[model samples]
Target: MARLVRLVRRYFILGSGLHLVACGGGDSTEPPPPVTVTITPASATVNAGETQSFTATVTHATNPAVTWSATGGTITGAGATITFAAPLEGGPYQVTARSVADPARSATATVTVRAIAVTVSPAAVTIGAGGTQEFTATVSNSTSASVTWSATGGTIAGTGTTITYTAPATGGSYTVRAASTVDPSKSGSASATVTPVAVVVAPASRAAFRGEPVSVSATVTGAAVTGVNWTASCGTIAGAGTTVTWTAPQSPGNCTVTARSVLDPAVASVSMMTVRPAFLVTSLGDANDGVCSWTHCSLREALTAANADPGTDTISLVVPAPVGAAVANTIVLTTSLPAITTPVHIVGPGADVLAIDADATAGSPRRIFEFDGAFAGSLAGLTLTGG
Candidate 1:
């Protein structure tokens, strides 16, 4: 009986101890949630060599820190916020924010890098009508570095960076544009001003007697200032403007008249004027005098002056009528007239109104007038007898 009681008491004590341990000895703390990371602005775009910012939101982590990294380009900063710099090369790039507590818990953002820019040389220029100008284009941030050219008011030739622009026949403002072949939207432009100038002179050719005044006019086109400057090679200009009077020189020769544009000195037009010699006969007697005055010029004296002059000469005869009952104005030749060495044309009032009598009492009768070798002359409106 004593042994049985001891066994029961030991069994009861062990059972009570097990029950107490099961009721109060177990741990009561709960485990933390999983670590998670998310990024702000999951996607973005930036230019080459440009910058972009990113921020990360960390959850269920003891240490709320992030490490920034990129597949391409450079990344800076720490913690949740980071700055990303795009590389010079273009295309898609990846940016990642990894959790410091757990590297496996990371967030990624896509960044698109664009690298196209265009520029044109000779930003501004001026060209004449039908003139040509060359332009060059420079492309940056692009591997191709090629550009297409276009013109608003001219024709473009060639392709790529270098091209020629030919101005239209008309004058006006124009524009030249260059666009990147990689990115057509990225373009540069240049300005062009076309100015066309021309000049024309009236009476392209003319014939004038020495000391005579000739009228000349000029026409200017395609210029802001439609005025011209007149210049003569062998004559004097009377006035200015589109119309001017030019006086032939005292000697017979070829003269050139030039009309230059006021806007452009290089543009001009020319006209030619021929000057010839002329003489007048005012006396009724045909005497060979040493001098030939303008007021009292005999036929012999006029012929002597005409022969002395160079080039083709002209003689005008005007003899006064007798006092009363005169059949016609008669010129009695006491001496023969001078031989015509050069080309000449003698013109009188009328054949019936004037008569040349070659009968000379002192000297033997001779031809009325002699012509030298290779001399070409004409006589009209006169009566000749007693040759």
Candidate 2:
């Protein structure tokens, strides 16, 4: 029994020695110390004065406090967590985290913040006076940047990517620019233009007649026209938007009219018209009366005698206006044996009676006779009125 007790005591001592050796108290093999720490995102990038955040870890560490710092910036952290602030000037920066127990074991992380670029579409737009224009802006290299767009020399409205601006009453060039809300230095710019609206005298001509209704057509260029007002000496017309119909003055003269755009009263044009009578004829010839006679030995003979002596008449020869025989005033009646001075006259509708005044002298007997015969009728219509 005593032998058994000694053996048990020896066994107990041996077991204690083995435990100490396994624990490296008296063994050649030894355990290693805590491993170095590694941090993800080895580097960090941020806008000037901005902050970045990260977590730090290490091997063989339990709730171990850590120290944090920035190589080229400012850092703030209590233990396994850290926040690194970017420098005033933008550039690459490193953040480090070390275990308080093993200062040699440290970790690093990197963060990147991009720069911003902005551009405007339709670099320049021209709008007529009193017009409006819309603008669109494109942003690049920035995700959370807000922009403030402005037109220094014009009227501006709206916000963000799409904006609108109105032209002034006058016309000129306008400069516009934009800046990022986060970084004003990273900005872009563009320009716009406003031009004067030109007025045109449509139809070009104004010739018209007085008191007549004239139609005038007008077109306003360089801008859109909504309505037109027309004025003339003849007075105003109704519904004269771009076309005017007015009556000219009643008097014979010239009239002028002006057409003005309703949207822009300053733009206008003019036209003119004129008005004037016409001349007409009604009579042109005369009639005279005298006498000729036909009488002789026969109505036929007397008629022949009177025609043969067309230059001699009894009334002309006997008149005192010539007094005496006055150069004979005679013409040969026929080539008979003795020429006779006979004044012949015929009267009656049917077979006419022929009268003859034969020889006549103050001292000689005058012979007056009539030839009444049916043959005289043949010369009845011989109406010799005067010579």
TM-score of each candidate structure, all chains considered together: 0.53, 0.46
Native-referenced Cα lDDT, model 2: 0.55
**Top candidate by TM-score:** 1
In model 1, how large is the Cα lDDT of residue 307? Answer: 76
**How far in Å is the alpha carbon of 267 misplaced in model 2?**
3.5
For candidate 2, write residues 1-387 as lDDT tens digits.
999999999999999999877898556656776667877666655566577777777778664777887767677757677677665445566677888778988877765554567887778888776677887777665544468888766677888877787766455788777777656776777777777665555555554432345677777655533466778765345565777676654344566677876656877777755432000000000011122211113223333334444332211111112224322122221212112333333332221211122334455543233333322211232122111
Give per-model CA RMSD.
Answer: 9.5, 27.6
**Which residue segments of model 2 deviate by more than 4 Å?**
1-40, 45-51, 56-77, 84-112, 126-134, 143-146, 152-159, 164-171, 175-178, 184-186, 224-234, 250-256, 272-387
lDDT (Cα, tens digit) per residue for candidate 1, span 100-150: 899999999999998777778799988776678899999876656788888
lDDT scores in order:
0.82, 0.55
- Candidate 1 regions exceeding 4 Å error are 1-34, 44-52, 69-77, 83-94, 111-186, 190-196, 225-229, 262-264, 277-311, 316-343, 348-378, 381-387
Model 1 gets an lDDT of: 0.82
